[model samples]
Every structure is written in C-alpha cells, then in structure tokens.
Target: MPIVEELIKEGRIERPGIGVTIVEVTDEMIETYGFPKGVAIYQIMPNGAADKAGLLPRDIIVAVGEKRVETIDELKEEINKYKVGDIVKFTVWRDEKEFVVPIKLQQLGG
Candidate 1:
C-alpha cells in the first residue's frame, strides 16, 4: 500500500507537533477556568516541546506569538506556520494570570 511505502521511506508522518493534548475552551469552560479565550491543555507528552518549555496540564494557551487563539484549530493554524526546531512563543493563562513560554517545535511521530 502507499501508506506502507511512505512509512518505509519517511519513517514518520513528517508533521510538526507540540506534544500536547488540547481541547477548545468553551464559553462555559471560560467561566470555570477563568480564562477569556484559548485552548485548554489537558495532557502533555513527556520530554516534548511543551514539557521542555515547562507547560503544565490545565494551562490555557491564549495566543501564539501576537495572534490570539480561541480554539484548537486556531492553535493548529498558528503552529503550522512554523517548522521543526523553530522556537515559538506561546501566551499562556494560568492561575488568573498570563505568561509567555518559548517552545521548540518537533517532528511528530518521530
């Protein structure tokens, strides 16, 4: 199959990833989490970009660079703008405060 051949050739999917399991912050969750708008990170991959950048579970990503993100799709759009090994600054909301973290992108499934 083409999928098998591609896997053999590339070894991995060749997509960039931040190694996070995120969910879109709903209007109700905004009140519950006390964040204006963002994607909620629930799980972090061990030793991955988020982990390396010290992003913890329950942290809400409000922006990528200067672009405000309100959903998982927006976050994906922002992340797709960068390539692997590029450091991207993420605006995070936690404990009713905002902070920035720089994370290096990594190849997904590698």
Candidate 2:
C-alpha cells in the first residue's frame, strides 16, 4: 500500500515535525487534449492537486494562466511558482473548445 494514508492512519505522519507525509505533485498531472493530441487522453498522478481538484483521469489540461502546456514537465514547472490556496485558471478540452476550469491549490504535503 502507499505510505501516505497508511502513515496517517498509523499515526506515523504527525504534523509539525513528526515526519510529515510527502506527496509529489507533477506537471503531467494537469493534462488536457489538443495540438498533436488528436484524441482525448487525461494525465494521471498518484499524489497530485488535480486529483483533489476533481479532475478525472481522462480530463485534459489545455491551458494554465495563459500558458499552454503540451507536456507534463511543462505543467509542473509552471505551477511550481505558486503555492497552495492560490486559484489558477485552466482550459480543459473535453469534447469541444477549451473550457475554462479554475482550480484551487492544495498543499502536497511535506
């Protein structure tokens, strides 16, 4: 099993310096369909903010803060400049033109 929840359940992950759980949020996480992406394919992340943002596995990430990301790495690097609780604008192409989707940043543990 993943260590996060298990650690939390077992009281292993204590807040404020008791070895906090760490979740990795990557760029590929926020994905969308467009450009060379002929078909719709959503990005996946085991530990990511998009997951909590209610983004599905097939949800595409078309835009972020006026920047269009074609790859996962591009997405991660861009969002890194911000922190949790910040509202970010994104264009998600589900079946038609890019649809605007605003996501709130959630802390990806320490």
Candidate 3:
C-alpha cells in the first residue's frame, strides 16, 4: 500500500467524510489523478465524498459545477470555488453515462 493509504488507514490524514481533520490524504490525492492529454483518473474511497455522492470508484470526474476538471489541480480549484457548508454538484462518467451528484462541502486542513 502507498504511504498515504497507510496514513489514511492509520488515521493520520483529515477525513472529512468521517468529519476528521487529520486525514490520511487530501481530496485531490484521494479522488483525483493526472493523465496524459489532460484526462483525469479517479479513485473511489469506499464511503468517501465521491462514493457517498454516488460516484463509482472507477468513475471519471469531468466537471465540478461549471468548471471542467481534467486534472487534480483542476479538481481542487473547482472545489475551492465553494466554501465550507456549501452544496456543490459534480459531473462524472459511470458506465458510460454522465451523471450529476450534489453533496455538501466540508472543511479541510483542520
């Protein structure tokens, strides 16, 4: 397992889904990834934000609100558009179908 994954398992990173600030990995690292041609790779965190929002672990997040997210930086920037306690919507591709999920935002970095 990756060091970050181990940290998460050891309760070292802030886990917003669990309402813990000391999460093992940031949202950008946990939910987003980089790819050539700007395509993004995604990972589902079991019961994390994306998972709780109905996004599959293998789903690709293409957009957040109106911003196109093709990279982890893009995803973080898009998410920053909203503040804590806000409800944000994301667009993802699952099973070749585009879907939207609206979930409340949470605080990060303690």
> Which candidate achieves the best TM-score against the true structure?
1
Question: Which wins on TM-score, candidate 1 or candidate 2?
Answer: 1
Model 3 ranges off by over 4 Å: 1-42
Give TM-scores for every candidate, taking all chains together and pairing residue i with residue i: 0.84, 0.53, 0.57
Residue-wise C-alpha lDDT for candidate 2, range 67-87, written one tens digit per residue: 877655566656665555677
The best candidate in terms of lDDT? 1
Off by over 4 Å in 1: 1-13
Those runs of model 2 whose alpha carbons end farther than 4 Å from true positions after fitting are 1-54
Model 1 TM-score? 0.84
lDDT of each residue in 39-61, candidate 1, tens digit only: 98999999999999999999999
Error of 2 at 35 (Å): 7.0
lDDT of 2: 0.51
Backbone collision tally, model 3: 6
Count steric clashes of candidate 1. 0
Alpha-carbon lDDT, every model:
0.86, 0.51, 0.54
State each candidate's clash count.
0, 5, 6
